[model samples]
Target: MSRLVEATTAEPANPEPVFLDFSSVQVATASYLRESVLAFRDLVRGRRSTFYPVIANANDDVRDELKELMRLRGDVLMVCTLGPAGDVNMARLIGDLDPKQRMTFDLVHEHGETDAGELMRAYGESEGLKHTTAWNNRLAALAARGLLMEVSQGRAKRYRPLFEDA
Candidate 1:
């Protein structure tokens, strides 16, 4: 575990995307994964980056365990898997998301940008969901968690991706 920290902090000033390459190794108990990967991610989250894994190769059991951990982290964290053709694809984070936040992230990811009013207006007329105050709280929380980038737009704010490719 401490070795993981050392490898991560090698370029602590501005660490590039770190990947715990799980290609050779085989068996990994859940506790082992949580202690190693999740703990490292939390430590990195406080500093320069989030713990994003790229599963180069792993067997069925190991893959299942890792997938469960990723799901627990939710959209705030992302992982990748190498395809047969060597293409990098974002792994599906299997978890429940608050409806508003799911929409917020989807909009920003799809449209490349969005604001609270835009979300409010869209949801308001489309679904009759008028909850601007709730939107404020939700967006603020997401920004603070580093999931979305909050930009002040004079009297308002716009949300963008923190690490997502736009």
Candidate 2:
């Protein structure tokens, strides 16, 4: 785990998606996955690290292990397929996202980029969100989980989908 963390530390110091490709791995134990993948994500994101890690090309067995681990942890991660040009061809979330977070994620995905106040006005009534604070908390939570990219515009923070077409 420490070695994996150390290896990732040498990544370029710029904000970008870091793909952790697992095309060769046929199997991975839950404890190993948790210690390496999950721990690396937590440590990097906790430090406000520049790179966002995305799992790629994981086989069914590895994916299953990760899904179970994430379900137990109540956290989520992005799993994606890279295109020939190294673009995200498709992406999905693993683990479980509560209804509210899922809703927030869908809203951001559909709208492109938005802020809490905007969501409050557009979805507050229909979504049972009465105040901007509620929307803000949801967006903040998604950002913390590495599902959304949080950007600052003056005093207000806006969030957008980390993947263009996830």
Candidate 3:
């Protein structure tokens, strides 16, 4: 576990998604998953590294266990299928998000790339978020959860889905 965790720690020069491929092998217990997968995520996130971890091609049993564990922990992870050329073919989120966060995530996914002001203008009245701050908070939360990638634009920040098609 330590060795695997260590391998994931090396920081990349530019921001890039790191797929933890689970193409084969059998079942993984929650305890093992928690100690290894979750631990690796925490370590990378803690360091504020650019290595975004995505659970790729996990089997049903493994996905089930991870979903249950993430739900219990109130966290989320990007899950996806990668094409032969290593592009994200299909993507979805595992675990959970609050209603507002989920709504905000949906908006971002639909828009491709957006900022707080745009979200407020588009959804504020309908969603009861009259202020950009409210929308910004939601965007920040999504980025913190690793669901979105934040890019700085002048004095503002714009967010996009971590996986291209997510």
Q: Which candidate number would show the highest lDDT if scored against the true structure?
A: 2
Candidate 3 Cα errors over 4 Å, as ranges:
1-10
Clashing residue pairs in candidate 3, if any?
none
**Which stretch of 10 consecutive residues in model 1 shows the poorest summed lDDT?**
48-57
RMSD of 2: 2.1
Choose 1 or 2, whichever is better by lDDT.
Answer: 2
Summarize candidate 1's per-residue lDDT along 23-88 as a digit string, tens digits: 677888778877876677667655535333333455667767766766775634444565678555
TM-score of decoy 1? 0.59
> Which has the greatest TM-score?
2
Which residue pairs come into collision in candidate 1?
Answer: none
Q: lDDT of each model, Cα atoms only?
A: 0.60, 0.84, 0.82
How far out, in Å, is residue 83 in model 2?
2.8
lDDT of candidate 1 at residue 10, scale 0 to 100: 49
Question: In candidate 3, where is summed lDDT lowest over 10 consecutive residues?
Answer: 7-16
Residue-level lDDT tens digits of model 2 in 93-120:
9988999989899999999999999999
Q: Rank the candidates by TM-score, best first.
A: 2, 3, 1
Q: How much is 78 displaced in model 1, in angstroms? A: 2.7
lDDT of 3 by residue, 10-128 (tens): 76765677888889847889998888778877777666677777888888999999999988998888889887899786799888888989988988989998999998888788878
